[model samples]
Target: MTAISIAPAATRIPSRHRITKVMRLQMVNRLTYLGIPWIITGVALVISIVVAVLISVSVPEPGRQAALEGMAYSWAGLSPFWYLAVVGVQAVSAIFPFALGFSITRREYALGTLVTFVVIAAFNATGWAILTEIERAINAAGLTFHHFTALWFSEVGAGSVWLSLFTLQIVIFAVASAFAAVYARWRAMGMLVLWTAVALVVLGLIAFALLTGSAVPIIDWLMGFTITGFFAALLIPATLAFALGWAALHRAPLRG
Candidate 1:
């Protein structure tokens, strides 16, 4: 019934946790949850930066090459993006679970979700930092940073200039939750189909508009679909739907 991310705290508590214990508990939980994301993010960032620098320094510059010569460098440039995506997916995987945990179990669930989001946040941050560092490194090398401008991309599958392009950690969680809800409610794939349809339509529109002129404004709006915009877009909805689910669950609580 409740989301794991935004459930309210219990009114009743033991005398031991009157104040200090409560504060201690919250802090402890926050730190405990944060550790995983931070560690994972750190590892991924380090590896990505090292790999990118290696590739960039190793690939010898050419006098003149084909149209796609930039593509090779582009590929080398993507290591950071890969690391970020890997970290991002991991981060996103925690979104619903954290929300679900917060909604259902009160403090315990909240704690779990907190830890998970910390991990997720860590990855998101890591992915971003790696890309920023890579760009700076490339700039320092006095080379052109190609295919990376503003905030849009040709495809989610293409280019790594930006980490969120490939994987918007928060959106995945939101979409995943929608899918899970559909699956649980009707054993249907309506959510999946809807998502697919939405993707196709959006992509088509972007392609058409791009052919005619820059669609940076449109793409920027769409970027809100990313985790960076999850709080603004999905969080409110997620919390609201979660509240409705809570009412239903209480009327007929989850079966043991």
Candidate 2:
């Protein structure tokens, strides 16, 4: 007879450690955390380089004018990474059920999901910082390269720039996760009602602003805050979104 060995049940790690393990599990073989960001950044940088070279060689006149005018480049280079929010939705729809089947609790699922979003956001922010520095160096060397830094971004300090980017991405991911949780719990009917209410509130706000002539003042007031301040303010909403999302996930149904 072969010898058999068994471990004691009391030897298992604590629940918090188990939850963290669940969180790390999501990151395994995951592309949203770093892979998609690198792909988007690489493609955007390649396109920028090619376009800059082409304009320099063929349409040198406009290129010269733009360089002289101190025109900023597109700040939308990393916008593609924003789709990670949608991926968050899909993760819940797909991963939550599988995780539940494996005996993971609702809290673990929610916390793991949150950690995954923050990690992805931070990784992208780091990539943005690296690209921004490279873009500045290239332009400083008189190469006329304008890819990462916009005029607005240039006005902000480098630390603020990266912090704002990281904070904004986290807030967006949190909101998206909440929206996804709503739909996952309520399905199509719930989503329709949610969107309808959102539209009505938005329209009412717009009408009120136009009627009262506060739109321009509102815009001006908004523009007064520094980017860091704006992102810091968003933290409140982000917290609410995360809370709501976690609550929804707590009672959400699982399906194949």
Candidate 3:
């Protein structure tokens, strides 16, 4: 009898393990997602404080109080949001190809990327909530500086603040993810077309609102939303963007 040769069956990784691995892979460069954001936040805080102090000093004492009080909103608090968009784009564009080379399936990569977005959004939101409270306390102590405590956040309770921030971050990240996925699938030309389409759509909407004389009504409708309600409404677009990103990545090439 001839000796029989048999090959062992290939071991399959559980979906959960594969997903977790991808998440870990994305986080390997923690500085991009975590450290840099905080650094930017800190820089923004410092700039806000400096500007507040300068304005206070520039004004007469009688007007200084009014000046600071009038600062209902600070753009500095929004700096991190912009950086988070970059993080979202890099999360896919920079990592998708690498992940594929490691034998990660497209499904696994998409799901893992989404999970990472949620985790990062939650983490950043928590930080923002804490900072908002701290800023509130500082302002209450009579400093009158606004960094994390934007006017909208000041109007809401703490829970609402956290929820709104979480929603906003998720929306920003999801939209960026969609853009990055499009880039991955079609390269630079895809991004150009995407942005052109976005610009035209925005212009069309503006033109419609202007010509139809519904701009005020639209503004009023939007302004009527409570802080939480506004962010919650944003969930619609966020969901669509997330879905679009996933679908795009489903067939994205490994080399891109």
Q: Residues 15-56, candidate 1, lDDT per residue (tens digit)? A: 434333432433354433345445654565465555546556
lDDT of 2 by residue, 196-249 (tens): 988999999999999999999999999998778987888888999888778778
Residue pairs clashing, model 3: none
* Model 1 misplaced stretches (Cα beyond 4 Å): 1-119, 143-167, 189-256
The full ranking of all candidates by lDDT, starting with the best, is: 3, 2, 1
Clashes of 3: 0
Each candidate: RMSD: 11.0, 3.4, 2.5
Which candidate, 2 or 3, has the higher lDDT? 3
- For model 2, the stretches where C-alpha displacement exceeds 4 angstroms are 1-11, 62-73
Q: Which ten residues in a row have the lowest lDDT in candidate 1?
A: 247-256
lDDT of each: 0.43, 0.76, 0.87
Number of backbone collisions per candidate: 15, 0, 0
* Best of the two (1, 3) by TM-score: 3
* Model 3 agreement with the true structure over 1-256: per-residue lDDT tens digits: 8877786778989999999888889889889889998999998888877878898779989888878766665566778889899988998888888888898899999889888888888898899899889889988888887777776877888889888889988999999989999989888898899899999999999999999999999999989998888888888999999998887788887671
